[model samples]
Target: MSFFPAVGVGVIGVLIGGVCLMSQRKSLFGALLSMEVFTLSVYIMIFSVVWFSGSLTSACLLFLSFGVCEAALGLSVLVSLVRSTGSDYVGSLVSGHF
Candidate 1:
């Protein structure tokens, strides 16, 4: 496996995930799914870097922390939104228009 290929994959994944996130911001599930994709891409990039460098303990730890934080915060917001609104429909959260 070459570093260039890994970098390319990571970049492409990030771009695709970002587009999904931006395009579906109106939907809570879509936003969560997009964030998951983005996080997976970041994990892939970190793993590739570790593979090439032969040391990734620190990177892996950071990745774990990042994942935990992302999941926690995302779920918290989702839960709060549902509790306040009594529904998980992302469209309802929007004020003006969809």
Candidate 2:
């Protein structure tokens, strides 16, 4: 119910998700999923803060902008990579020669 605990938990979740992403970078989908999870955790923290502090308008706007940009950028990069390499596995691209 307290803001501190909510923010703390969100930070922990984001950290854990980051670790997961770094450890699983060989897989494209895994990294994307981890990033999505991290983004969601951050959104949760922001929303919680907004709720407690009564700043929902700015927080929600920021969240929407960030979420849309993140999704678009991630998907676009993934699609381009896949199209160039003809594979969805990131490991293959790293080991390949241009």
Error of 2 at 14 (Å): 0.8
- lDDT (0 to 1) per candidate: 0.82, 0.82
User: lDDT tens string, model 1, 21-53?
Assistant: 999846687788888888888887888888898
Candidate 1 off by > 4 Å: 94-98
**How many clashes does each candidate structure show, in the order listed?**
0, 0
Candidate 2 weakest ten by summed lDDT: 89-98
Clashes of 1: 0
What TM-score do all the candidates reach, one by one? 0.79, 0.77
The prediction achieving the highest TM-score against the true structure is 1
Our model 1 lands, by Cα RMSD against the true structure, at 3.4
Write model 2 residue lDDT over 33-86, tens digit each, in one string: 888889888987888888889765776778868887988898888888888888
